[model samples]
Target: MDGIHINENLMRRIVRSIDKAIADDIPQYLREHYKETNNAIIQLRGDYINENLRNLVVGGDIEFVPFKRYVWQGRIIVDRAEKITYTITTQKTLRAVPRKQRDKPHFLQTLLYIENGGYEAPVKQMTLMDLFPFEAEALENDYNSIVEGLIDPAEGYRHYVIAYDAEGSELRDVQLEFLDKDFNIIETASLNEYIKPDFARLTDVEPVDEDFNDETDGEAKGLVTIKSGLRPKLRDVQKQA
Candidate 1:
């Protein structure tokens, strides 16, 4: 066995322990308690999973915040005056999750609201492509629609492109422009960025050999050569003087 295997085994044990702890503690709470609710249970499970996994993987002064749903509001401006309000709901803006594991700007759903007598009323509720017929034409013409055909069913959400910070740790406030087939900006919207903490530190783990065999004797065993099988070779070692 190697260090990776050992670490994975340790993680599995820890996860099992945490699961056992949750199971044991759940009975102490009544069914009417909020902890017994489906959302609460899911949140608790996610919290435990992230906390333990981060402790095992990142180590030392690191924290993990699980992903949560958020609604981002922006406005699409047409002709520099005609503006429409849009709202997107997604589970991408993780508070303290790692950049690699964080969700992309996936849209769970989108609502386009048109101003009616100074009050916004939802006019359409769908993807950008479905909401605008011109987007479909643009797609057929090989024009990138900013957000088209990026839906992930497995993700159970919608997707839109959003700017990230330099560190890629958090979303950045920026305007996403909707372009026509001619690559001209037809509309622009200001996207609200979700701020995330910068305390996460990723670390590398060095591998070490793990003994798998239990049988042993007092005398040191000589090298036992094997044929017709693979053997481990030492690489990248400095030659001794």
Candidate 2:
């Protein structure tokens, strides 16, 4: 039941995991396979991220569960120790907005915010329990079993949105948006600085070996050219993973 705060160190780990997936893994997969639809690409990105997070992050209190306990397609992270839960969602824009067009909250996301009183008041498990008064005990047990890492109500509930822009098969930026009771963005933290540089394509470079020794005798050997389908390198080059 501690005050809610953003753990920068933990956030860094999440950012690094995402950076590797979107920048290195996905692009390479696309290069090696046929093109995928936008929806399929989104799912692939989420799977790669969750897999990376499970591997790179170490913690017993962290749990991956579907948002609202039923939306498997919208899986999210629940950190019991931190008393904060967040979901990594995608957006076309660099900034993550709660609403569809920046004016209204998405229906599913709104349900979560409303259930927590939109941060205006502390959430109470009793309030939820009261709804199923006829079968409180049984329902509580079921809910507990379903939500393995429910945030302690006494600690109060805090929700954050981790939004990333991965348009055009490249990650343009990543950010954390803090929201108030009205779903307005109260603050933001950009994690782009922590993202590793983009991977560079090795193209048209001659081999380091100067001599190509062969039984061809005096036959001349021309320079060998290596071809790649990846785009040219930018000024800030990233090491291949």
Candidate 3:
């Protein structure tokens, strides 16, 4: 099949929209949706997945300069400054294909990551079991979590999530740190929770999705009550319920 053309500009727009939409819920959404494919727990979040790939390649990072172009094995490749040549392909590539089935946004991010001088992150082999109930063997077998890290000797890839409250004034980026036997903020997600209860810890007492009440049909659900701030009007004197 002839490869599909992915316009760099259009792809950028779509990625921007995706990152904005997902800046809140995408991490969880990706984990739940793409867990089965490619041995990935959080398939959408790849070390090679560049939400900002276009910029990294073109805009300011002139450090990565393309030196030459060559055609080999039915694909035109771009050779960069460091004596490395990259094949120029589109959605036809294996990494691009599986990701397309998972999520378009994540697919694009992965491609961008690959094109910008990084090894492709093994997102295709991840699963939910690896995320919620990950074991040492499962992690070792899969190529995603640690093996794909930018820096080797990068052991202990723990996703320590910390939550914060946004009190309608300003956004305080409380940098999250993770711990060894001690503590530290390893992986961080920039979340904007501008409402009540900004976040609940995965360890926090799990709230029921639906409030549980043992009472009768009409005796009010979970702590139903009249609003205290409901101000009565002068017209209330004219009539009564």
Output the number of the lDDT-best candidate: 2
Runs in model 2 deviating more than 4 A are 1-4, 35-39, 67-72, 93-149, 152-154, 199-231, 234-241
Writing each residue's lDDT as its tens digit, candidate 1 over 1-241 gives: 0000112232232333233223322322323354323433423333432343444322222112122234212211111111211111112331111122222322211211101112221233233333233332333322122223322122222112221221111123333333222222334344332121122111122321233112110001111111211111211121221
Reference-based TM-score of each model? 0.21, 0.59, 0.20
* Worst ten in a row by lDDT for model 3: 215-224
**Winning candidate number (TM-score):** 2
Stronger candidate by lDDT (1 vs 2) = 2
Runs with alpha carbons beyond 4 Å of true place in candidate 1: 1-6, 30-39, 51-241
TM-score of 3: 0.20
**lDDT of prediction 3:** 0.24
Candidates ranked by TM-score, best first? 2, 1, 3
Q: Model 3 misses residue 127 by how many Å?
A: 22
Residues 93-122, candidate 2, lDDT per residue (tens digit)?
A: 212232224222342234234334445423
